[model samples]
Target: MTLELNQLSDQVQALSATAAERLASLERQRPAAEARLRAIGLADDELQGKVRAALRYRWAGAIPAAEPVDAAFPCPPHPARANVLAADGSQVYPDRHGVALYYLINVGSIAFRHGSGEAPRVASRPAVFYEDADLYEEEGRQKPVEKIDAERDRRELGELARLAAANADAPAVALLDNGLLLYFSLQAQDRAEIKRELAPYLAHLSALRDSGAAVAGIVDRPRAAGVARLLHLHTLPMEALKDHADLFQQDADFRHLTDGALFADRLQPGERSALFENGSPANLDHFQPAGHSVFFFYLNPGPAGRHALLRVEVPEWVAHDPARLDLVHAALVEQCRATGGFPYVLMRAHELAVVTVAERRELEQMVVAALVRRGLSLSVSHKAQGKAWTGAGRRRYP
Candidate 1:
């Protein structure tokens, strides 16, 4: 009722028509992209040369790997007796208006024993930060949510590493409900700060690598166009790429295309696309030097008709080892088949980690009781209290 849909009917219809036109345009462009993919696969060396030259100009894109660009690899045979370990993390961000000024991170994991038909082991670990160092930056400003989210990501991978190491009896595949590359917006941060933030995450990856576990990061319906950007670079004349400034900024035919949309029809159910090395500075400059360069492939872990595309990223160690690569592919397909499209373990882990509203209210109540025991004020900010009073009601105007 607040949205006034009737007044927006014309605009909605126009938006729908624009969407339809965009789809048609994308369809017309698909064949050319596919052709370019095939052409580059036939002459990968030429593309590689171009990628090498273009790397200094751009921040992040995709670089071709050992696999042919057009290759559609079938799902490899899964291990008869393997283990699948997945971890997910959720957080309660600090609310200045609330009684407490702290954030919490909870990581949930599942250790599934394949071929034994035994029940999977699940666990969750939660930690709260209240120290000034944890809550604020050197400038005395409250730490941003992105920094906290980075910590949560680190904990998720750390949990997977711990579980993978312990469940070493069988070949283990450690899964994360995220991309292997760090997602924190580090472009604005100083080099020293960036290095400090990435240090712990890299350490955890090293742990997973040393544990002899195949690790993978699963992203459902990814909208990444890193590969598409590569294709655009391929389309440009080699001479045109010398201008590092305008090289990637130029408007192009493939601008609207996503790797998912490009590969949606190409990959059959249960098939995966060829691998591509991620060209992000974070992957190339930091992780690669540490022997953990991120590589990715698109997979359709399918039941039949539905095209549930996923981007699976792995470290250099896993990507190079045939057995580890195959296990990640096979195990992921098996996990997806159990839960329609998405991985069942990730679903369960998320469920275990998520904090519901009632639980948050209960936690706040506990905080209030503790504050009262300490003879501290048990009052929320006036703005928050006012919202609590009128949040569910509607306002009328003349």
Candidate 2:
């Protein structure tokens, strides 16, 4: 076997022991941490100043609320008649050794109408990019995977806007499998180009806002240590604080606990944490200006002792409004209830978006067939052919 299980046993055993010890230690410290949470208050002016200093040095960690908030508010009952709309995307990256030098992106969406008990609407759209113009960046080099992924994210939002607009009469919630903040990939992209990229999508957010639809980005099993990082900052001495490096010094103190893991025991089933705005530079710089500063809260949608913590991200408008936030919260849990602790719409959307390996090969075959019809010769790399041949074999004793 490729993994050599016998050779890895000792390492796995050591990891298991380390994990058990950490869990016990974290449990032992829970009472003190919760006490700190209760005593926490937002020192807004002072906190903002620290954030600015960190930003000056290009720190990328989450900026937390001016004060600590770990409120475990119960979930509001879902509206008897509401619509849940969700969109997800999948892509086939450009392959140099394939039948054609092209890429494809497909988005799948669902508009699930609750209360009415009617059949849900579902659809998928696939786009293939083959032209030289579509394949190349502004600098004439092949477009990177980051650009393609960003476009996919944009298209997911675009589809949500279209769906939300179509169902404007009713209360609609648009859900994405990620955050609403501008993606980190844009840091590597040109500033002007990034702004251009954001314009249309931001306009869509505005449209949703005007229509009074709630938009949320749901992250399952989130690994973010935003709040944990904030708590670490609290332990730093003032002398070392200005450097922004102090945040990392105590990172190991909470390294084993994620925001979700820490909140899992505190939140009852169907409960959510108090809203906190993300302090990331991306949110502060681009999203906030457009009234879309990203805010998030952890939710336990699963049952007691089996809490499924989800980090739900919403724009500022949704965060400030109690009714809108309730709808988003209730609808998500309700959706999860029916799908075994995960949003059913998201699962269906992903299934519809995903491109299986067999389907990809068929697409390549179609491209090859079309080229042959046009009397054009195309060749795959010999290395790729060799890999395919070797990939199909199995070891045996004779």
Candidate 3:
């Protein structure tokens, strides 16, 4: 009994010491966290006020109706044909410790002009544009394998900007598969690197806005707006949404359902969706250029779970001629077919649409075959639709 008492005493003492240390550390950090809040034009009292207001609002369960968009905008009989360019990037890496090591297997950009009836032109030369495997090492023991930090992202944006600038005088608009802002937060070193890298391109976007040239950042997901609605329903202040509480564990299940099971099947067993994290309000804030205010569109899913044509009318400053936009859409469809029926977002002067799962699988197979014919060894997994193909040592075309 005496020995047991002694052991208990020691454990109690140690726990007390640990608690004291934690309390002291928290006290020291409190002032700094508050100072950061203030520096960022926010304060504790202000935050509480917003949270209180959010709590007072009633929750609305129904999905909000989308506002009607004007599809037919008046155009001059001889509207100047604006060039449309679509760019996308793909990375491949070994699934093991090679996580951080990625082969930028492809960084392709396709450009097309209206009324040409020709296929969209490939911008990156086959040899010059593709980058070899680049090693990105992290600082600590628990480092990230995918080095999608701000610096690397910024470099990518810089390259895209240069491409756009080279063709600046071509009376064209640049289409990016992702958002304009390449980086999310500047709090971390990697994130800050991304910010620095994208700064030049953002400035160029500003110039385009001022020059009355149309440029847009197209995204396919609607969950972002859904999260925004959840925040509104919960009466959480917009500022608090920056912390992305709605994307936390409490709401993760609902958010997952929103994406539907189609894409979810593609994820590895333990892997989580990166969409919510990438499309968070905090990340979207970095897209602001002097004259450009980013606009988001929500495309509705059809009865067959396919995306019907949904139009996101561009602001007049970034609008392209309708005929030119149609040509670009046609090229995108062709590209989808070429890529093995891989579905892609179709960007038009008036709207954005989601590519169906059927189309996506078809595209993947087509692209894989093309790569095989070129003598490159390739393997593809298409389990999302309950289908997959494996190529053995021999590069046989499927």
The C-alpha lDDT values of all candidates are: 0.88, 0.81, 0.38
Poorest stretch of ten by lDDT in candidate 3? 64-73
Which candidate leads in TM-score? Answer: 1
- lDDT by residue (1-398, candidate 1, tens digit) is 25688999999999999999988988988998888888788436767878888887654778888888889999989989999999999999999999889888989999999987899999989898989999999999999988998999999999998999899999999999999877773453566776788889999999999999999999998998888888788877778777766556733677589898889899988899999899977777778888999999999999788769999999999999999999999998999998878989999999989888888888889889999999998689999999898776778788
Q: List the residue pairs that clash in candidate 2.
A: 42-66, 42-67, 63-279
Lowest-scoring 10 consecutive residues by lDDT in candidate 2? 59-68
> Model 3, 159-212: lDDT tens per residue?
445555655555555556655544344344454655554566567666555543
Q: Candidate 3, which segments miss by more than 4 Å at Cα?
A: 1-80, 94-102, 117-119, 125-146, 149-160, 166-171, 181-194, 197-204, 207-212, 227-285, 289-293, 299-306, 309-398
Instruction: Provide TM-scores for the models.
Output: 0.95, 0.91, 0.43
Q: Residue 108 CA error for candidate 3 (Å)? A: 0.8
Could you arrange the candidates by lDDT from highest to lowest?
1, 2, 3
lDDT of 2 by residue, 99-173 (tens): 689999999999999877789899999999999977998788999887788889989998999999888767999
Question: Which stretches of model 2 miss by more than 4 angstroms?
Answer: 1-3, 41-68, 184-189, 237-240
- Between candidates 2 and 3, name the one with more favorable TM-score: 2
